[model samples]
Target: MTTHPTGTREDWLKARLDLLKAEKELTRRSDEMAQRRQALPWVKVDKAYRFETEDGPATLADLFRGRSQLLVYHYMFGPDYTAGCATCSTIADGFNGFAVHLAHHGVMLSAVSRAPLAKIQAYKKRMGWTFPWASSSGGDFNFDFNVSFTEAQQRDGGIEYNYQREPAWTAQGIGDTMTKRGEGPVAENADMTGTDVATYTRERPGMSAFVREDGVVYHTYSAFARGLDGLWGMYQWLDRAPLGRNESGTWWRRHDEYERQA
Candidate 1:
């Protein structure tokens, strides 16, 4: 027998109707937020950022592939990471499906990582993703966007992420634990990426938007942390399920990690 609460049909209907009103209110608020996002002013980008794509070198504008708008997912695959971050990999698993559709609709979707081109290509192939991915290795693109931090920045805790300054992990008492898992988010994902906590943390996950108009590219918007919840395909589905996310810590891994499911 299930442990969930049971009730009469009329009782269930009453509860569901109440939830439906709240759901509609949430939907309206979400629509308002979308309008606000669209109304935000676009800041012109002057930096000459370059990236290494599968097809030779390309500029940030080139990633749009003739589209007027571009979306870049800041994947957390640092230069020294042996593998991609598990959480990022899971988030990206849904991209290949919608990327083609987005391109057709005048928007381009791609991923940018601090890893080398070869590493990014290998991981993309392993994950069977056909979307365009670029490498920002040896470039200041990630750091300038506040998605990456230097050792000095991490040590001093003077970096801004998710629109606020966060204390350095070291200052927060996050020790380097290469072999330990389940200690915390930093340690767990660090182990999954086959790197130390600090190295894995140097790169953070985010998404940035750009718009090209009349030979100029403008930075339109960016979102970090839970701001990206809408873009995460899995969570959208889970939110509608009876039990919701039902998460207790990180209970997910790279799609390929569960070989038995394959």
Candidate 2:
């Protein structure tokens, strides 16, 4: 016998109707939140940052690619890692499908990582992805964005992420902070990426948005951690399923990792 509860069609209809009301309320709240997000003031970017792209060296503004807006995915491919983060890769797998649509709508979407361009190129080819991936190797772009941390920052617990400073380490433990997260995901993802825990923990996944107007680039907004839940296309689909996310742990892998089974 199935463990799931069985119910009559009428019962399901009554329950679903109640859920529908809440869902509609959530939809209204979501629309209001989006408007508030767009109302945020844009901060002008005056720093001279550079990135290595397939077309050659490019500046932050150049990433616009003639579009008025730019969306950058802060891919967690640290300089020392042998592979990109599986979680980030899973998120990126959906990018290729919608990237062109966004481009046509006057937005340029790209990924930035700290790995060397050659390493990034090799991996991108392995994944069969064509989206524009740029290398920030030897640049302060990642550091300035607070997505990448230094060794000292890790040791001292001085990293600031999600616009807040992480708690200092005490004899009790790493205090109330989401940065460390847990050893399970951290160690598992680190081993998958072929790097030590420290190396993997130094990098985190994030996304940033910028707009260019009147020849000035302005940093519009950024999201990290759970803030990026909306962008994970797989989760968006899974959420509608009967079981929802149906997740317990790190149950995903790089897209290519599953190819052999097919």
Candidate 3:
């Protein structure tokens, strides 16, 4: 580090060196991320959560099927809730295409929700996703991980994280929103419909890598529902161009402002 000599030979040399150093730092960071990506965390699962797979009753371990690495997208499909979540849909659009090379890397991806198999299947067909999907209806898995919630809890109040429930208290902070009600256990102002910034607020769904040795399937790690956002980075390439395919590229208006492609 040197003082501002102002336009001397030293300044030019220092500037060039700074650029090179920045480039190297960026490269180093990228390399570090690559290592972390390869270093998938292993988790131990003891709870036997229930789910509806393409077949029948499925345990949490059943999700992994035969793959060593599993990824589950937390889809929004509460049974009584008819429409899929808009934000979830946007994320799904980003996930339209797969590289087909994930399996070679030993990662299998799927989507899961609390909806019935029929509902999940219908949405998958509408979205044109070939990715695997499952339903969690029997247990509190959705509520447990904070993906879905009961109307009383969601309306009366609760924040669904990962897949568990946290009562909405209101010290006016993280776990204290309900305290703002100035009444009792639940807050009056506490919103039933969740906040706007909760785009990524859903818990990271579970992704587990199971290893079976001596006839026992041990739990490795089950990932979050929302952590799959990066798989569709290819969508970023579209923003470079202009509005093609009738405003598909335009952020000027919302999805509803125009009609669906008929």
Candidate 4:
């Protein structure tokens, strides 16, 4: 028979201890970032932003629906677009649980996109998500938050009426504004600026938050594709074999080999 190491038990225990330490470090970092996010500058919502609530036809202020704090996730779902972002849908799938917990914290959270009410509702059903997903059919909110693109700008690549360009982490609510929300001459949108608080939405990250004295709610974030790896825990599907694969720790699977079939 082959002989084993004299102190393999100690080695395994040491490895486990190291894993615990790393997990604690990650928790500490998250706490630190949360505090920093709270301290970040916040822009003011000057004009009354509009949204289609579950009750139908509501103003931006109405998004809170009575709560003081609000969190608006600018999911990508424009009228011209075919499907809502798959990655964002995954995040929403997980968000269903958080939606209830957030209310207990006195913080309200909802998702908005530029798609029509009917389309958005249909997509929500297809994904089986019960979270507060709403439509932003009439407003510059999507473009302002960098989720939706302009006609001319979308056609930059020569594809007419397409929203293709996906830029890396653009600044929050910084872009060209259409005439009265796509009616007049284009100019740099400076309406959602002013507070020391600046917010942004782009790739390579997963979600953002804003806090305030009266309560913080802002239109400035989107979680996409790999942008949501760090913020996980909902999917029991991830309990299979190792998620991080190869030399890159970024790859992961949602299910085990045997359970993948059913």
Candidate 5:
């Protein structure tokens, strides 16, 4: 009565064993890639970037919090948005648990966004998240990192993200183009954030790594798009599920929004 392949226990074990070999090889490759990432050269940060934290104004170095390393999640919360990106929010949910562990291990983790400090605080409280969140409002940090873009940049195709040039977002089709018949992930995400596709897309989600050496901050690494797959905790578990990701369009929501959907 099932559509899936039927197999005896012996058959299942044989297939699973074959998969185990591939999985192990993937794990080994992942370890090698991590080493390569650590080997990448770091670029010195000379600009004096500032942020607004709950504790008041702070510099990029202060984000390390006495630690030598800092990991910033470039959260997609533009100033105009009423809420955070659902996908980014989901990724951040995992941060609250591991941030303390990172802090103990000489690494401080925080999330930076273009939204104002007050808006960030209200949303942080609503989500019950205690992890450090900072506001880079009126700051060029996001733009310098290629995670935030202006309307002119969007129209001129001046946006370069994920290490490549992105196509210009035309003003005429801004809203219509992003929403594919008012469906799919982008449109759904835009609706969730209470913004049109143009505004929602002005901000991007990514993570950046930095290290403070001898009182100077250096950029170590950055990842975007699919490069961030490893940090999405739920996806790791889903990969081991019977149906794997089993995705179609936008099938996820902010953890709290699920209750309302039901």
Candidate 6:
């Protein structure tokens, strides 16, 4: 009655054992990549970046919170948006649980966005998330980190993200130059955030790492696009599922949205 391949227990075990060998090799390669990532040189951060926190104004170094290291998730909540990006929100849901463990290990984790502090706080409360989220409103932190862009940049082909120059959205078939078809992941995500494609695409999702030593902060690492796959906890579980991701299109929502849909 099933469409999938039928196998006896012995057949299943043999196939699973072969998969286990590949899985172990992948794990070994992952470990080697982490070592190489750690060996990358740290770049000194000379700019004085500031942020608005629940406790008040804070600097990039203050985000470490007496720890030597800081991890910032570049959440895509542009100032004009009424809400956070649905995908970023899903990734952040895992943060509330592990942030405490990281703090105990001498590393502080926080999320930074260009939205105002008040907006961030309202959304945080709505999501019931207690993890540290900060506001970089009116600051160049997001732009400097290459996660936020301006309209001119979008139109003039000046935007660069994921470590490469991006073709201007104007030149693309979507955004302002094209009619809204209300289709595809980008358009759907733009609708979810209550913004046009141009505005939604202006902000990207990524993570950055910093370390403070001898009273100076240095940028250690950053990852964008698919590079962030490891941090999306749900995907790790889905990868082990029988159907393995089973994705067709934008199939996820903010965790709370599912409750409303139900």
Please give the RMSD of candidate 2 to the true structure.
2.4
Would you list the C-alpha lDDT of every candidate in the order shown? 0.88, 0.89, 0.54, 0.53, 0.92, 0.90
lDDT of the structure predicted as candidate 2: 0.89
- Model 3 error, position 182 (Å): 20
For model 4 the local lDDT of residue 217 reads 50
RMSD values for the candidates in order, in angstroms, are 2.8, 2.4, 9.0, 11.7, 1.9, 2.3
Error of 3 at 178 (Å): 15
TM-score of 6: 0.95
lDDT of 4: 0.53
A best-first ranking of the candidates according to their lDDT comes to 5, 6, 2, 1, 3, 4
Report the C-alpha lDDT of model 6 over 3-37, residue by residue, as the tens digit.
99988999999999999999999999999999998
Q: Which stretches of candidate 2 lie over 4 Å from their true place?
A: 168-182, 259-262
Off by over 4 Å in 3: 1-27, 30-41, 94-96, 150-229, 232-235, 238-262
**What's model 3's TM-score?**
0.57
- Put down candidate 1 lDDT per residue, 1-262, tens digits, no spaces: 9899999999999999999999999999999998998899999999999999998999988998999999999999999999999999989999999999999999999999999999999999999999999999998999989899998887887779889886655533433342233266667788889987778888999999999999899999999988888888999999889899998756778898887534
Q: How accurate locally is residue 219 in candidate 4, as Cα lDDT from 0 to 100?
A: 37
Q: Which scores higher on lDDT, 3 or 6? A: 6
Task: TM-score for candidate 2, please give it.
Answer: 0.93
**Candidates 2 and 4: which is better by lDDT?**
2
| Backbone clashes under 3 angstroms, per model | 0, 0, 28, 9, 0, 0
Off by over 4 Å in 5: 171-183
What RMSD value applies to candidate 4?
Answer: 11.7
How are the candidates ranked when ordered by TM-score, highest leading? Answer: 5, 6, 1, 2, 4, 3
Model 1 bad stretches (over 4 Å)? 171-182, 260-262
Native-to-model Cα distance after best TM-score fit, residue 206 in candidate 4, in Å: 7.0
* Worst lDDT 10-window in candidate 1: 173-182
